[model samples]
Target: MRSPQGVCLFSLNFPPEPTGIAPYAGALADGLSKAGFSVTAHVAHPHYPEWIIADDYGQWTRTEERGRTSVRRRLHYVPRTPRGYRRLLSELTFGLRLIFDNWRYPAAIVSITPSLFATALVALRLRLTPNRPPLIIWVQDLYGVGLAEVGEGSSLVQRIVRWIESSTFRAADHVVVIHERFNALVTQELGVAADRVSVIRNWTHLADPPNTTAVQARRQLGWPADVILAVHTGNMGAKQGLENIVDAARLAEARNSSVHFVLVGDGGERKHLESLANGVSHISFVDPLDDHDYHLALSAADVLVVNEKPGVASMAVPSKLTSYFNAQRPIVAATDRAGITAEEIFAADAGLVVPAGDPEALLSAIQSLCADEQAAERYGKNGRQYRDAVLGEPAALAKWSDLIQQKFRDSNQN
Candidate 1:
């Protein structure tokens, strides 16, 4: 029997994935649970950024409880190479499992995307059910915009993807977007009603860094203490355009500069990026770190970096930015000048912005920051201030809780 305060959440990524959308989804589930909702999250096995499932989690199906939430993990195709077609296959496999699984009628439903295809399938199922519960489709990444930006397929394919995305969004009772910029895109481009969409910015999920100097952090991590360390953390994917970082590192090496580039985290493109940086002594790669070490690495960096593929503007705002802000480290973004990322950095006064895919310009920005300590300090301070004022965790979670309660009331009324 479904409880009055029960909420169903569909997320392809969940806890143990450790990067990208998983952390945010996990946080939301926990927040909802704490708000007195019984959250039953239907999720896939932990295969993300790395795209490989662990040996111990080889089960076809599993169920577990975490605090007030019940987690059901389903087996899906773990694509070794998550290209366009293979990725679709993976989502299709997950969606088929979800469609066949027994579902409890909850007060409301929350669905997250990135597995946009799977979410759309679930949305279609809800539409056909009589007296379906209200649904909030969380927009983590805009699928159609991502397809267009990445140039994955032909124009016809892009149009079809947009149509699917639009239909899925329109089926939702309400839509939650992480950035204000997504409002126009959702309402105008995707044809969702303006009133149905709300912006709830993502908050820093990482714990505050340990109290230690950069020198201490460097020593602990075994990194050189005498270099200007520029670090980029998170997934090294196609959209990330991490090759630009490799090229910039090459430039720094050629100029005999003190800046050393560290690419942290794993993804589909890590091998490709490693190949690109082969024989480039200025660049190094670090495996994904635990919570404490992750925070420590950020604290040790002289400049934190965000890199995006050329023309990837509206598709996403890097999730890493929230943690970067919390680290109070100066950032340097190499992305489209007119994109949402540059706008965000500019708004927070967080860091420098250079054109995407420009090796020389990126190198120059890093060198400039290394040369000016006061300016770097100011940028870091501004970012921390912005994070505290705009991205408080309690406020964001309360908004979500209120939305769920209101939806439940509306459902009960009908």
Candidate 2:
């Protein structure tokens, strides 16, 4: 028998959830298993972006195996609607369950934050144990700040959340951050030491896309031959500030511009956005595509998009960025210059950045890309090259395995 993998991961998100951090989490677990560490993931029922338990998830809890890794998905309370208090209650219910649950084998615990409170419980519980597992709190998204970013939560709520965050940060032996800006916030703003954090840029799900031309894709997608196609795929949630995209589309339609906007994916704000987009002929929404079509659409598009509302910086890095890069298309990001999305796009020289929450500016950027073919092609090439170098699978997966060895295996031996 192979050496038992001394790692256990606790997180609310996992695969078959459609969007958010599930794909990334699943990728990590799968990679770890392939690298010869038997992994166990306590996956909570999927209740993200859409905020409802998917009908097919079935019953309270069940255990399944993903290759060598075993996954247990528990039934947690899912609020009928996605709201702050309801979400908090769900975390409380799930965290408490995990806290009281058995740990027959001790291993270095890897807990993720989204339900930051749940991770806090694990951190606190580990502290009370005599032989505490070396804890690693994975920072995928900043929760308290994210709530405020989407125009939810109050000052009191934020304070309580931050207190939990600070406590958990202190509790973990090492805090892993996927984006550099997150590292800055944790150390400079949250009072954590700089040395305690590790940055591993996320790996992509879309790789070595079949070389396809936009003209051919437009034909397959049943789009007009002359219009420019700009597509934004992934979750259509509040934080995305999709209204800006809709408004820009409306303006473009009014001006009879050649540029067209298409949004693909589902989320809480999708219905509301559909209502907002009712009369705009140039703007259209498509349901989530199958993998083959998704890749085709991405590779075929003239441009990709990443948008965020104003005053919403440092909370999320938009997991869609990896997919955008893999699509080999230049993008237009309408987000704060201070945000990670803007920083990464500019650093990769992947696309153009416009003022956050400005429909007029978004329209201008889209038009300019349509107007200049050479500049757009250059950006596309640069992004594809950067994705291979930085976000490529071999590099990211090796970094994760190295982390497991350094933080989990090495510490165990000593």
Q: Highest lDDT among the candidates is held by which one?
A: 1
Model 2 segments more than 4 A misplaced: 1-4, 223-225, 409-414
Question: For candidate 1, which ten residues in a row score worst on lDDT?
Answer: 1-10
Q: Write the per-residue lDDT of candidate 1 for residues 1-414, one digit (tens) a residue.
A: 335688888899998877899899889999989988889999999877788996578588999997788999999998888888899999988988887787788888899987899988889888888878888999999988998998788999899999999999998989999999998899999999999999999988877778878999999999999999999999989999999999999999999999999999999999999998999999999988878888889999999999999989999989999899988989999999888999889999999999999989999999998799999999999999989999888899999999988877776787
Per-candidate RMSD, Å: 1.1, 2.3
How much is 99 displaced in model 2, in angstroms? Answer: 2.6
Model 1 steric clash pairs: none
What TM-score, over all chains together, does every model reach?
A: 0.98, 0.93
What lDDT does the true structure give each of the candidates? 0.90, 0.81
- Please provide, for model 2 over 337-370, each residue's C-alpha lDDT reduced to its tens digit, 9 standing for 90 to 100: 8788898998889999998889999989988986
Candidate 2 lDDT for residue 83 = 57
Candidate 1 matches the true fold with a TM-score of: 0.98
